[model samples]
Target: MPPAHPFDDDKLREECGVFGVVGVADAASFVALGLHALQHRGQEAGGIVTHDAETGFNQARRIGLVRDNFTSPEMMARLPGPIGIGHVRYSTTGSKGQTAIRDVQPFFGEFAMGGAAIAHNGNITNALQLRRELIERGSIFQSSSDSECIIHLMARSMGRNIPDRMEEALRKVEGAFSIVAMTRTKLLGCRDPLGVRPLVLGKIGDGWALASETCALDIIGAEFVREVKPGEMVVITAEKGVESHFPFRPNRSRFCIFEHVYFSRPDSILGGRSVYETRENIGRELAKEAPVEADLVCPVPDSGTPAAIGYALESGIPYAMGIIRNQYMGRTFIEPTEQIRNMGVRLKLNVNRALIKGKRVILVDDSVVRGTTSRKIKEMILDAGAAEVHFRIASPPTAWPCFYGVDTPQREKLLAATMSEEEMREHLEVDSLKFISLDGLYRAVGEAQGRDDNAPAYCDACFSGEYPVAPSDMMEQGFQAKTAAE
Candidate 1:
């Protein structure tokens, strides 16, 4: 197997983004707008699906950002409908299996029972088992994503209505998920029992909306209502205002802690906690746990920049932009080779030698999945004449694969996974290094919740060894063998 860059050093990728609407005049357009609001979640691809009684269903999907793919002109030309669903996908399973337009969401399928399309957030832990079982029974597969596994399960179930099949499918699949789907006449939203991912419901006049983040609701003038609870499923239709059901009884409401630490947008709120506050807490905690003497606190780039601000404020040290990232560059920029990307880093970020020269700087970053990018950044800082660089990480080590949605690689490739903090510090060749204690992590996010404990039972398994669900064979096929070599 080749080396897999599942958890590259640049940034840990979020799994997917989902948006759905009902009773809107320009349903496809509104979904496009909503997906645009969530463009930060996933940049690999964007798609939309709409349905009207008069024209049936129509869809537009492409490989790019929502803004680039679903423009106003494109949205206007799309067949108008009253109900719709949209998805922005990032790869959890990067095998070529689901990278195509057909494999991308919103995934469509027609069965003898009926037909439906699903746009999903989060990874299915048991997807491989389910896919194998379905395959043995002659269930054909279109995409490699575990998200497609649910569609097949729902289609094959002996249920008359879409909701019935959905319920049956939900019962069979295990792990973290926040799924939004649409049938000919209805729009639906469902969260996994543990709610490892965030999902919310909102309203705009007579219309209703569902999105992975509240920021999306604000984008299209929707009132932020409330979060969809774990173990709950919601169905919205023309006849009913909003119907709710809990196929799975209450389990621990373990929303992913990383969402607060890194994944979600700063403006978005997840599980009643503000992402900005969570990041601030990490900064404050990093200050308390690993105080350092430095002329300036510098963030690696965008994600770490916020935490760096917090750390600067708490430590009473001024924050400076040591490295500047190129906002124009897309993740899939046409760099055909790693050496090209390595050269592109200078294009990606440049050091302001004026600020760092002759100064002992404290460098803050979200996490170090692999040692490559961090090493380059450190050398860049040193070359810019920083007297010393002290590295502070906001989260604990990412030593395990996330069975949920995040695409962390197998344990071995992660520097912190196999090496001690001191060993990793040597690997990166920084002057000194420190990571926020696991207890400190929970303390930061937990403080915002008004709870004394560090982390509310969210999925911290990426930082800690505890996993919400074991990695499925699908995850094994997608990441393990590839990650081992990297």
Candidate 2:
């Protein structure tokens, strides 16, 4: 792959997506479907591990989209099992551009009990510390991924069984994690104590499923059972269904709020609320907080569509598809020659010149990350003869990097970290720019009275700069957390 178009590269990337299904016929086939639904969460690579009595444990890991690698009959034939788990990766804690096959997951390991495979989402904050300690104690590591720490930890554990060993391993680990694993006869799922990332349970026919989001389950025709509660571990077998336990200390949940803003597909449900409705509510909140008079409201295409519709309905401005995305634009390029590189977002999105020629357009977008996409889009809208361009972002300013799982730029590389709203507006050269307030974001996500400062319901660390789990690795490298007074 030459490179992902910069048009899609500037946003905060979800680290990975995980899906596991047990008790289904040809479970790896269903796992592939679920991973395809979650391709947005991770497009870099994918893997599936399946277990059967005859084959024991089998896996096929590949680079690129799930549809490209996992869908073929020949590929699916290599994996055979009743119980299976799959992972699609975006590489938050590993090499970025040159990810190796060794780093692709649904990582497999053999133990005294049996062979087990695990797929993980979210970053391990203490992975560096654990890796050093494990290496000192003579534990060899295969890959450069932080998630591999879990396998090593399990290998060193003295617990009686696989589940007990897993508990022992996770207890020594810190930071956000939602994991799906499989043994020859069982499927396993769990979330960190604080539940900083999402993991949901589902039922399909006589079988059960576990996925990072409900959308993945939907693809395999699974019924949404409920979320795997914070700190809860579920071990599912065809005979016993699901057995739940808590292996970590009790703590209040702090789910990632950005999932509602951008990470999840709009059709999915989160916290018992429709993600589409929540995004529209975000638009309504943004309208109330920063009302802008404009001739039309336009979305920056798919991600921004729902919010734009809400803004248009609330502000009584006509909604238009002022910008149309090139639906078939391939994510990877063969090579980025100077001519193609300069095309910028035009390669992916284009202005509806006919409709936008004389309008004062308000563009509703999900977030402003590096600000490269926004600036280029603004230039495109202007070149299309739009009278004025105004920007309304759905989420609050992303001022800090997410240490949990989201692939965020270093704090200083983020536009919000170094510039004020007015400065950003000037930089983008838009008539005006605004982002939804944190309190407004809370209200939109179903908190009627807005955020509770003492203990927020969701992790807004990227916006608020307060991490629920201290990023120990970053601290070791001399990165300091922003204090309340900062």
Candidate 3:
């Protein structure tokens, strides 16, 4: 396995991205285009499955960027069909060190009626228990992925049709999920009861599309349709359009709040709100809640730019790109040994000595995970002669690990898990460190009265340490949840 990119080590990673289309010519081509737009969600590997009447089910899976793997004529030509689904992934299940071809999805399975391919976003908390029970009952497991359990469960189901089997399989499963699946002629989309992950419907000329985010729809010039409601399943075909059903009991939406902070593309919209606009609002809220008398407001590069712009506008401070990022750097540039690992941040970002020198700069970033990158970046600014460095985080401190689809570090490794705000400020050695309050973050995301303790609008488990869904697997492994006494 190749070494990971240096800068990406401390970041939270979404497990996967899903895109599917029905009723289109060379549907794999459209799927490829959509995956390219969603590369940010997952970058370790990608796969696409397509179905043609004459040729039957076809697929292509590769480990690398979408453009690097899926754009070639031979790869596209291999997948000749009118309906298809594609997945881009960063492995949260299966082998942790490196992703093998077997673990790559959209996972294909042969059922009694026909073959279907499924791509899943979000984690299944009860997968370990399910796998053990299935194996005991003579189910042959192939990949080490939690998602494959869905296929096995579907195979064992006594339902009349493929969708019915899927419904039965998912009914027994727990945790967050947004799934895109396809049979020979039909495309399908479904979200879990909590709507923990995102899946949207889109309309093309005579076709339909489903993607993890709206940005993928825009890449194909598809009209944005309504989102797939929580616990809802939609079966789409060229002739019949979209057929909606409720698989699980209705529940209030608990969308991942980090989608606005750092995950989804800035150009995308979530729950009728623009993600870019929300980040800017977070900046405004941060400026209002935690103001600093700094001469300039600077972002930590690409992810923090929007919020920094908002902060600058609200605070009447000049906004500047104090750090420049290398746009062409893909996931892995060089193999990281102990010493080479230290050079990672410098290879990706460089301090703008001219703009930063003699300026009291306030750094706006989405979140601080391990405090490794934040410390290194602070050192770079001081070396460049910045008078003072202040950190204004767009979201509250991330103290808990996410058990949903997101790949978060263990609680012990998270800086916020062990340290208070002042302790963290002293550890990072910044002039001051302030994170947006939980209520402020809620307000920024359009929750008018802020987060309701009675019924929160979004999944803020990372901030509040109060999980909406039980992490059954972790609990079995003896991981403790926050008690009332704490």
lDDT of each: 0.82, 0.91, 0.93
Tens-place lDDT digits, model 1, residues 82-120: 899999987776464136666578888786755688999
Q: Write the per-residue lDDT of candidate 3 for residues 294-346, one digit (tens) a residue.
A: 89999998899999999999999999999999886655666667787667588
Give the RMSD in angstroms, all C-alphas superposed, for model 2: 1.0
Best by lDDT: 3
**Model 2, 171-204: lDDT tens per residue?**
9989999999988888999999999889999999
Worst ten in a row by lDDT for model 2: 1-10
Stronger candidate by lDDT (2 vs 3): 3
All candidates' TM-scores?
0.92, 0.99, 0.99
Model 3, position 482, has a per-residue lDDT of 78
- Candidate 1 vs candidate 3: which has greater TM-score? 3
